[model samples]
Target: MHQIKSKLLLTGAAVIVAFSFGLNANAARMDMVDVSNNNGYMSTAEYVSMRNEFGVKAVTVKISEGGTYKDPYAASNIANVQAAGLYINGYHFARYATKAQAIAEADFAGQTAKAAGLPVGAVLATDVESQEANNQTKTTNDRNNTAFMQEIAKFGYRSDIYTSGSWANNKMTIKGKTGWIASYPYVATGKNWYSTNHAWQWSSTAKFRISYGGFDVSQLNSTYYTADQKSSVKPTDPSAVHQNNQTANKHQQANSSAKWVKESKTYTLKTAVKLRTGASTSSSVITTLPAETTVKTDQAIIQGGYRWVRQPRFSGYGYLATGPANNTLEYVKISVSNTYYTVKSGDSWWSIAQRNGLSMYSLAHQNGKSIYSTIYPGNKLQIN
Candidate 1:
């Protein structure tokens, strides 16, 4: 009788250990959800509630082509989700119109994601589905898919392609990046999309579980939250508000600089225009120049100004009257450098500086400009 009791006790202990192991395994899996088209633009409060309740680990928000209509909740929603301590990734619905179009669409989505300040774990995913007729155009679709992912990679974030098991295995051949396989047991036939994957969306309703994926799985529901959640957290950068104001100011400056008038003049001097005599004597001279003149332009000597010359009678050096200084001849009347820049749509002084491998402050200094200086499309900028 005693031996029977010992056996029963051992069996009960084994069961308890097995249950504990299962619970531990569940905690390790990555619990995620595809918020693609499912939530019809949830409000901040709704998002917060979902995070607080569900323990959702990650969310994949859908970004449509052309980004003509982005998730209204994207930026703020990401902030709220991050505040609730959840990971967020962006998914682009491939339009498959053209390779260029697909690339453009992905660019727009990546820009939006970066602008939202989504930190680590925010990847740009390409959502490949069979509904689009272009899906049959395997070559075109494949080309577009590859190009789109490449564009997303440029913005310092990883790329992923999200498709069903069968579509991923049979139709797509994404070479470099990871895949987020959509395997709904009810609908999916294949078991896994790839031998190596960064994530897997096994079922929409699956609870968050710890899987092979490094992150913890999120449970599906309105109340999902992740391990990253915290309460009443403020933005890391206190200067963000000030920086935003500064950006606005710089944008205004760019517009103002773009408005400057380029006039043809036959100055006795061969060099580009400098301030007219005493231009800085008072606010009057500075104000007289078209609003296109950059704000806080340096009084130091440099080449290039508001005037250009098509033809010159003499090529030899000659003295030209520059703006007012203690000595009229303070600035050397040297010819302007032909290196000029025509502003592009998203061109910023900082961006230009980065492209040219120049420091923002140094570029501004060399150009006799300020950080707040404005530039615009078609505006000619002197680059010496």
Candidate 2:
């Protein structure tokens, strides 16, 4: 009887452990879809139909080849996909080394994205395919390719390195913001390419029935935009300038009473407030304000010698200074949390927030910066 009882107890424990493992395995199965046509061969109607029918979440279009700028179709495709409500990102097929060549590719991609009015959702990716016939070029291609991504980041976009799961882990040391792994079945068995990635593309053929070949697979999807995210997607058309101006005026009216603080002691002011060619702070006279200035508890004080205030109410704490503040500071009591994240190459505000289980708004608020705010390796985030 003692032997029988012991046997029964062991059986029960085994069953319980098996059931727990099964549940966890099921939970780890994530649904992901990819929109990649390697040769710039996808049609516009096909792309649009896929987005509409399958609810595809993100699209990766090619912008360069052999370390040189090529293709006009990439811009139109990116625009059409974005207009249809899907997120858009770009990739470069790297096969070159000279810094000039890399910079050219980066500039070309940036110009195309700017023209299309598509804010890159991920870093402008560097796609390294092993089948290319140039072994000598391939030897130095990895380092040159990384340099290309860093150049692109200087243009205010993220850099996501793309390669097979095995190659990226074994051969590449991508120190950009993030890694974009292209492993099918969304599983990394031996050496996962994107071990430190914030997002992963797990499959190629899964579909939302978006015309048989397309599907949407993003973690977050919605039409509503917070003021900060909205500001990043400002209209580029000249005729819409008046409407944009009016909207800007309205935002100013809404946030006119908010306080302004500088992140740096010396900051440049753009003649205009857009991402391109706006005023920047010179190295001179970047100083902090006296403690008696009376900043609101919710407001951000810009440090680093730059003068700009974050408009938390209007733009969700990501908008940089348009100009100086017009009102006296008022303090508000709010609960705050200190958050820590290890910065990877190609990390953006969105990716960091998503990884650490925080909302973009909360992250920006705690750090007192905007969505476009620059963060480097080993930066600590404070969430208020």
Candidate 3:
């Protein structure tokens, strides 16, 4: 839970006991990224971008780890930062302790960052701490950190080693690699703190509340950044960035603009899933919706790796599992009891009926059309 920038002064025998601090009382030039898992949500992005407010300059995100440790919503978070016009960088929670292991992690981090289209200038930081090394001696930690930083250079990106300031000064050798210190709220004063330090992670929580996306808060120093790093990554709106084409989210505008003729639509839940009190999995579970159970949703959004839908009379979104284990949930759109549907691309009477849980025979009958009739994209289906 730390970020970067700061200075320290003291050398020789007295270095450990006496060191200087540098604090920028004016945070106007400072940038912030609340470091935490809460960033998995995009509401933070929309909140920050309102009125073109440049409250922060950049955001840091998790990119990869040893196994399937990739952040589920990393892409969404990155896209949100881009839409907010903020510089985007990423870090990996280190799991390796040896040079070979560190190299492998760096390779994974490089590939993941590349696939995500992270800006070239954004620093790829490595989170190396005592726990990452299992409380190994400083000698072993120094060798691994040095090797990891050098390997990251192969990816054509600058690298910074994130460690506690105490470790930077007293525990290990950090001379070759750029240092990002994670000493919180203990701003050093006077006499120009350590000049080698490039960033200061000053707070985990304070001031603005929404930025607390479950992460520590820190600001980066421009001195350690390149001109390109300052360029805000302008990404497409996060709502539209998806690697898969889910039918439920297609041509969403038609429904967005369509006038609702009914209060709710019937949907058959093809598989069992949880109906939570809120959109996120962190929300309390209202009930476990069993397989083949009928569920209804008036509103839905892609969030927290699932389609959080608002069931009828529910105060908030209910979590619907989108993972492989329970992904058979379907949004049935049938022409039942005077229901009408605006045609969408590739939509037909049979397809529409099937999608909505209506019998093809009954759907064609209510719409005043034969089974062989053709329905254009814009045609409206009225089932009475």
Candidate 4:
């Protein structure tokens, strides 16, 4: 089965399931619900109702910790969300000094989240920035975070990453994992995938009363997901489809003319648009995009009285319907050289360099890490 993703630029039509809803509603929330152990332990029958009443369609529950300790109240909180029939998700607070530590924590987090009722289509994220780089270089710390995310992916769930925008851009290896950006006051655009924030977390306010404690609310923008992904946990191993194409290349938007007539193009959405499963309007909506959304396409097709742009894989939704005559999605910039590698167990700088036919010093220097430093399994390495 295809992997469930929550990234800005996922590749492949069958593998992407993300949420890309921007165009904020002033001060109101326009996305999912994310709570934690800090929200207190309560078994309120209104857990689901209150969320539904507030327009909450999904819930992100904290399951594991920055270390190995499980969230004390995660099970109860998860049960309430599950019992309430809300979409289920979970995250781990990362606290890793080594690649091994990150994997162990990811294993613990995945197991805990699974037992606590994490659903199939739901995402498991590594909450970085908590001791993410205690004594190590930023590269080492980023490897840990990437390893944590990769280990979580091994358990069958799609992976996401949570951290500040500055940290993500300047300090971490954020290629493989989809971004769940935390930026207060919400920045409209950044260096990541979206022109705006993808899965933007707007606040940590304690104003919303939930169950036995207060909950934090967030907003979704420039990202979206599908219902099948939100379904209960299943036996489908997303690793089945794992490859270099799983994540979008930040260096280049690959494969134009595969869908669109052009190789790299851009467009804007004037209205809320839906990606249809087929070229016809009557086809099922694959995903929905917010207004003013900007996306890149290499192809377009005319059908159902609408001009549909072929979506680059992992750009969240596919086949964006552009009605605004001014709407245009084109490629703007390209990086120097986009090269990467996913670390495997027992792999190190020397081994990676030798295997890839790269010089040890060059590889280390390219990734901004020392040759003597530790590289974790599941983290993606920038080769050149």
Clashes of each: 31, 37, 17, 28
Tens digits of per-residue lDDT for model 1, 1-384: 001111111111100011111222212222355553223344445434333333234566665545465665566656554554445566776655578777788778777777765443346678775234122455767777878878877765556676655556456764433566654333222233233555555433232122111111222211111211323423233243223223322332332232222323212332233233331111122112221222222122211211111221233222222321111221223224335567799988767754442335445666677656786798776553
Task: Work out the TM-score per prediction.
Answer: 0.42, 0.40, 0.48, 0.49
Query: Which of the predicted structures, 3 or 4, would earn the higher TM-score when compared with the native?
Result: 4
- 213-323 in candidate 3: lDDT tens per residue? 123445445345322222333223322211111211122222223221222544555445667676654567788776567666565443222334467653544544322
Candidates ranked, most accurate by TM-score first: 4, 3, 1, 2
RMSD of 4: 22.4
lDDT for each of the candidates? Answer: 0.43, 0.41, 0.50, 0.53
Ranking according to lDDT, highest score first: 4, 3, 1, 2
| Residue-level error in angstroms, candidate 4, position 17 | 18
lDDT of 3: 0.50
Model 3 misplaced regions, further than 4 Å: 1-30, 34-38, 47-54, 186-195, 207-214, 225-384
Indicate the residue-level lDDT of 232 in model 4.
35
Q: Write the per-residue lDDT of candidate 2 for residues 267-382, one digit (tens) a residue.
A: 23312232211112221222332322322222343222112344333433333332211111111222222335667678777676544433454466667775557888778775
RMSD vs true structure, all candidates: 23.8, 24.1, 17.0, 22.4
TM-score of predicted structure 2:
0.40
Error of 1 at 175 (Å): 6.0
Q: Over the full model, what C-alpha lDDT does candidate 1 score relative to the true structure?
A: 0.43
User: Which candidate tops lDDT?
Assistant: 4
